[model samples]
Target chain A: MSEPRFALGQRVRIAARDVAVHHRVPAYAQGHVGTVERICGLYGQPETYIHGDGQPFTRLYRISLAQTDLWPDYSGSSRDRLDIEIFEHWLEASS
Target chain B: MSDHHDHDHARTFQPDHTEPTSDAALLGLALRELLISDGHYTAQEELRMMDAMQKASPHNGALLAARAWTDPDFKHRLLNDGANAIKEMGFNLLPIEFTVHENTDSTHNVIVCTLCSCYPRGLLGMSPAWYKSKNYRARVVREPRTVLKEFGVQLGNDVEVRVHDSTAELRYMVLPQRPRGTEGWSAEQLAAVVTRDALIGTQRDLDINAVAD
Candidate 1:
């Protein structure tokens, strides 16, 4: 079994990239910094799963980000937060 | 289960768009027929699976939540290992990751599938049409408070709202806080108040009076 890349509460940033195919990372979450809320178990890469390529399991993490930080004009209470599940390959540790 | 099945009727795609049934429905029927004829799966087995899926509803989740609310030890197990905890309740949740997010006075949670309409269909049956809408998938993460407001869930400023985007394999269901004034209610009674919307985290207030309705 492969170890998880990031631990809970660890701050990490989503890698901003433009992909032309199926991916789990949403457009709103790209390049946003958030803390790992939960270390969701490993799963096959979704981009490959759609094409029937299910191998090499990747770690998944649920990262939590403040709504204010995610959107420039987020018209909501500042305490609101958004949690998105991101794969290990799409994240980088932020020091 | 107030016969609110009309929600799916307002979906963007109509069943009679091209023929008597939608293209996707026609394709699904053809695929099922081919699979049965090819000996991949029997029609009886397929019908049994469909019946099992239809039997799954929010009642399963409500029973789990009600049990947890009344039992501290069960609640601990539920929060720590949701899959096993649910299994202990005599339900099999295989090939899917099920996580329970607890709601408290300080924090609230909502669930959404940003990538697609991935949901805990084994436990909650079919997902609401709004949950699979393009608008909901796009806006819930960006403006959860606003989307929740549209759902009539207004959180107090002191309580921080958290939106869980089910983008990957893991599925989430909110363990809504036990409603007040039901202090001595039976587990069956408590489960009666728990609606599908409450389990999905769209609605916070679970009305005991609504149980009669």
Candidate 2:
């Protein structure tokens, strides 16, 4: 509902706290920090998807997280990274 | 290294090979009957919808990939706005969002649906069973290089393996790099070499032999 709280190339962290809301952020990505890769257009909240006409559209973003940051003992190329789309509500500003 | 659920998937589902006689099936039938009787849709409309869904195939993605390889402008558009670009190619994508990930020499892209197997079904047809398997959904985001190896795609550290975890609203398809030895091949020939796995990122190197004379 609020204008996209984050901007392109901005650094942000996914909300580590578990909330009682239907969200798209993955569990593994929670609390991890990443760069905003792309500023995708907004869409309805997942909870309101079934009958979402007239519901406010929330800004969605594609965040790129380094593989090294995701796992403590990742056994793959350090160059590897994971990108996942998350709603603005589940993200917080991070240094 | 771990699973979200403690139980085995095999303990619950074997519905694929069996006929539907479960409560879920009855509920589905009831819903269908209600919709039809309530004039929401006729049985013919339902059949037509199913027919349209079945019409999806990897051939659609192949055509897109080949066209992108040949036409720079089309490729730019495809990478910028996937849904519109695909519609320009004569494919009416569903209302959901679509994004095309380009696999370059330095960066390899793989797609997975961590929550559920969300894919660009409109462009590339139904997802492969393995794409929907829990193992792939779990491992692809964690140790993608190892998973790629299992799928016969060996990537080096020089290339960044970018794993995309598709969400409910957004879906992804990878536009693999054009294979070598096709100096002046036609779009048709290039499409012939594009496989479903290639479009999904599991199969990167296109077999040049597929288009050989």
Candidate 3:
């Protein structure tokens, strides 16, 4: 298992890999920038878990993305947000 | 044991979504038979597991929610480490990660499984069918305010709506803010007010009417 690369409160971007496979990140969340709200303990990667091999469990994080940043014409409160659990490989350090 | 059989509403989930049912059912039956035939699990074992899962109801989660309302320390532990907290309550948790979101004055929390119907079954029982519907899975993340309105829950712009999308790794159960009045009700009495809909966040306030006289 790989050690967690991201820390809580760190800004990270979800990779925009849109190719069709068993991916966990929803299409709407691709390429979105969000802050890591938590460092969930290591777990099996879903992309591989579907194909019968989920070895090398890696880090997962609960990311908080602003609701306004996600939708083009979001009309809700500015404080609205989306919390999603993301696996490590799909994330990269963001500014 | 609320089946939440409120499908009478026309627009919640498309009641006519019968396009792919047979295909999924065929696949499910095939998988079950294969598992039994291969001895990975017997038919009786499969039935027993189904019964166990079905036996789990929203009552378990209601107990915890009511407990949190009554016990400050337990509430803290539940919010901080949901997995251990539920286990401490004598409930068997699955290997999957468990987390709880608390509703507050400034923010209202709701849960959805955009990818699939991933729910905290051990704590809250089988998710209502609408939760697994294509309509809810797609709309809850997009227009939560409108969805809440459909459920008769109207929140002002002041309360930020926070939607938690279950990406399947971590399961979530929402802790609703306890309603005012019934100041000295027992924990069991308080549990009666926290509906599964409120626990899921589509509904916010507890239905005090549910408390037995």
iRMSD values, candidates in order: 1.2, 1.2, 0.8
By lDDT, is 2 or 3 better?
3
Off by over 4 Å in 2: A50-54, B1-19
The positional error of residue B31 in candidate 3, measured at the CA in angstroms, is 2.7
Candidate 1 wrongly placed segments (more than 4 Å) = B1-27, B33-39
DockQ-based CAPRI category assigned to the predicted complex of candidate 1: medium
Cα lDDT, all candidates: 0.84, 0.84, 0.85
With a 3 Å backbone cut-off (N, CA, C), the pairs that clash in candidate 2 are none
Q: Rank the candidates by DockQ, best first.
A: 3, 1, 2
Q: Candidate 1 vs candidate 2: which has greater DockQ?
A: 1
Best by DockQ: 3
Give the winner by TM-score: 1 or 3. Answer: 3
For residue B202, model 2's alpha carbon misses the true position, in angstroms, by 0.5
Candidate 1: give the clashing pairs. Answer: none
How does candidate 1 fare on TM-score? 0.88
